[model samples]
Target chain A: MTTLMAWRNLRQDPIRFAATVIGIVFAVVLISLQTGMLLGFMKTSAGLVENAGADVWIMARGTSNVDQSGLLNESAYYRALTVDGVESVARVVIQFSGWKRPDGGMESVILVGFDPRTGMAAPWNIVEGSRDALLAPNAVMVDRLYADKLGVSKLGDRVEIVERMAVIAGFTSGVRTFTQSPYVFTSYNNALRYTNVEHGGASYMLVKAKPGVEPAALAERLGAVLTKEEVLTTSDFASRTRQYWILTTGAGSALIMGAALGGLVGVIIVAQTLYSATVERLAEYATLTAIGAGTGYLNRIVLTQSLIAGGIGFTVAAVIASVLAASSASSPAAVLLPPLAIATIGILTLALCAIASLLAIRKLYTIDPTSVFR
Target chain B: MIQTPESLIVEDAVLTYGKGEFATPALRGVSLTAKPGEVLLIRGPSGSGKTTLLQLMGAMKEPDKGKVSICGTPTTGLSQKRLRAMRLNRIGFVFQFFNLLSSLRAWENIAAPLDIIGMDRGAAEKRAKALLAEFGLADRADHFPKQLSGGQRQRLAVARAIAHDPPVILADEPTAALDTENGQAVAQILRDLAVKEGRIVVLVSHDHRLEPMVDREITIEDGRVVEERGPARPKSNALRSTLSALIEARRAASGDGRGGSGARQEGPRISSLS
Candidate 1:
């Protein structure tokens, strides 16, 4: 019966309830997008390293990120193959190069050259082309999402990378770049012409461990002989690259801080809405207090009202955020509202609303018990 | 020592508001009592400590001095938790403004007290429906407070006050906002609760129309009772004063004070509360 009263009270002022729900919807949408974008950027920062099929990476010493790597000596690849747990090793060359469009325009591109036969360090989200296309003469693959930015309209378009002519043979999808510099995928021999690395030069070595062998242990074994190079498991290198962007570079932290501010704004929206609605009915609350309503029961009434508002607001907001996120899945700014991110927003929205309800409960507590008659 | 069988007792209760130099007395050692099956009216002008005395009797507050016992339970010095329980199970308050939850319908407003006492919703709803039927508001049960007429709303307030079967009912000007017909109707219902239902009904109001229904009336002035007591004083003088005051109050209430005593007042009915 009390719950019925609470529900009725929520609907008693439709305009006020709508205003409250609108506030929560705005707050939730802001929080969801901010959190989703933050997670997306963090995941994008290590996209290449995480997708590599290699169990371990042998790169030049002091290599913090896979994209910003110094060339490993040609001998590092041969030395890693000698390691006990090493099953196979593939040479990979990644270099930042300027792509001069046929229209005299220029944009930054990461020229990722890998062994087409081994398929290690190759682009995986090939939406319109095959990996075998990289074997064609001067052939390369570029993300279809970044085609406009890279000034390449379609397949068979020719562009010059670091002054070397390259032909686009394949188009991939969702191969994100933290720097927003589209990746240009090609064969190992093809990359040697476009980069500073010579024919036998290797920037990094992708090492796969034998089945039942731990990559970390294999990395430790490879680290013994590769004195001038660093041997790290793929997971470790991926984490290092991710941390380098989000924490070390300060850009990621700025995004994280923005998300926190969104949460703070969310708290304020929920708190103000609930507080105003509860305060407006203070006389009714006071009457209840005088008629022997206990603190717990009164608290339940206010909290129940908040939960209803939050439930409705969150449902609408989540759907809006989810649709917004889903629509951007194929765009350059693909937002990843993974289950964890959705769950995180759900928990945060409810927790913030619950905390906001305490303001109303506190007002009820400090009120003069018999002020209803006044 | 034989104890009084009164369902409500207030013995020289003293309550002061504020601290130090700002302190002002609200109840000045006022004493009163009433047994079950009686309607007691505390009539006084504004700021005469009438409501304060009612609050004390209702166990909403403890007196600074003296004791108030309701049905053998002494309210003085009891913890707020205990007082809350005492009020929930024993005392019901009907306020001047009708104080019905505006969000709820007529039946829900009546069921509120029952719900607060931890009664199950189904049983509480059943009890509220029965009370609504008994109060001559059977059809208005589904309506909200704003939808009902002034008289029906006050009648509903009275029904809510007795929903939990409380032995004691305290009302602060329950009919102050109603017209004469509504006021008379509300007053008669309160009279029935005391005479027929065997409950103690205490009213704090200066409305003259309530005079004929009450079994006892205490007129307070400046935080003390207007006790007309002396050997030379005739007992009929008390009755005469009561009748004259009633007429004067009716004139003032009706806004025609040409030959009536100017007894109607306003604001902070409890003295020294400002």
Candidate 2:
């Protein structure tokens, strides 16, 4: 009956009810979209390191993240291979280079050079062709999300990077990085050919530990052999990469601030609407109090009402966010509505509504039962 | 300690609203008692404090001095929670505005008290339906308060107040908003609840038409009881006349006096039927 009363009270004014729900929806949507974009950008920052498919990464000294690393002597690969518990080491080259589109427009792209046979530091997901496609002469792969921006669509399409012509051998998905730059994958030899760098000028060394060997321990041992480079576990590199982008970049700050603002707006709207609703019907609540209804009963009613509004608002926000994620899939800064994000936003919305309800319930405590008689 | 057997009792209750010089008094040394199977009518002018007396009897307020008891339980120092429980189980209130929740239907309004008392929903609804039928409002069971007429609303309020079958029923101007036909009908229900159901029914009203239906009539002016007439006590025209003369003399004196007795302050008051 108390629950019914809550529903009836909200239903008493449909315009107000809709307004409250719209307020919650606005908040939920804003929070979800901003958080989703943040997650997307964070994933982009850590993309190569997180999916490097190696136990450890060896970068030049003073390296903060994958994108900010200096080049190491390619011989560091042989040094890591000679260490105990070392499986196999692959040399990688990452450099920001200019891409010449078919329309003669120039755009910046991160050129990654790895051994296609070992698949180390390669794109994790290929949407168009197999990873083996990189074996073709002068071949490179581009992320599907950034393919249009790079002016390439399908296999056999040709583009030039650093003024060297290359064929689009495959298309990778979800490899778009926070630089909003497309990741173009090529073989180590071809990357060296395009960038005109010496063969020994590898940017990082991807080290795989022997089965059952701890990466940190292996990295520690390899540190002794390759004193010129910094050895880090794959997880450590990924964490540092994510942290660097989140803490040092204005992109991270903007996304975080947007999300926080959305949450604050949502909380204010829900608090104000629920508080006004409570105040409007304060006499009714006091009437219940005078009739011997306990505070628990009244609280449960308000909570039930808030939950109802939150449930509807969350559903609406999730739908809008999902649509946004789908529509922005091809955009440079993709909106990522992961399953976990959806679930988190749902929980957050409900918690916020519950908190907002408390602000309204506080008014109930001040209501004098004698006011009913008045 | 022996306790009064009455369902509702007020013994020399003195209630004041503010403090210091701002300490205006609403009820001054008033007393009231009602036993089971009796309908007591309390009549007072606008500021005579009749509502305060009813509030005290319902355990809704505590007296500054003396005592107000419900079902023989002294309520002066009872905790708010305990008082709420006592009121829930023992007292029913019908307000002047027919304070039915505006959002609820007539029957749902009647069933609210039952729900609060933890009655099963189906049982409460069944009882509410029966009461609506009894009050000739069965057809208006699903109508909201706005859709109901003034009389129907008052009748529904009375039904709601008594829905829990509480031993004490306090109706403050139950019929003030209703027409004569509906006012008499609601009055009859209050009377029947007292006479047939053996509950203590206390009606506070300025409507003289309801005086004849009650088992007793008590009048108050300036927060003081002026007269009481019932089967238990002899009717006295002399007492009424003397109280009226006293009120005139007090009014005349206040005109020439530096400060008037603020006895006519508007608020709820408690008075006794002797």
| TM-score for each candidate, following the candidate numbering | 0.90, 0.90
State the weakest 10-residue window (summed lDDT) of model 2 chain B.
B265-274
> What are the runs in model 2 whose C-alpha is more than 4 Å off?
A128-130, A154-158, B1-4, B232-274
Query: Model 1 over residues B81-149: C-alpha lDDT tens digits?
Result: 898888877777888888888988898898888888778889988888877777777778889999988
- lDDT, candidate 1, equals 0.80
lDDT tens per residue, model 2, A1-374: 88788889889889988998898888888888888888887787888988889899999898988876688876887778899998888888888888999889999888898866567988778888877778677899998878778898889987788778999989888677877667888888888887745797788889888899999999999998888789999989988888888878777788788877877887787788888988988888888888898888888888888988889989998998899888988777878888998998899899988988899989888878877775
Candidate 2: docking tier = acceptable
> Judged by lDDT against the true structure, how good is candidate 2?
0.80
Stretches > 4 Å off in candidate 1: B1-6, B228-274
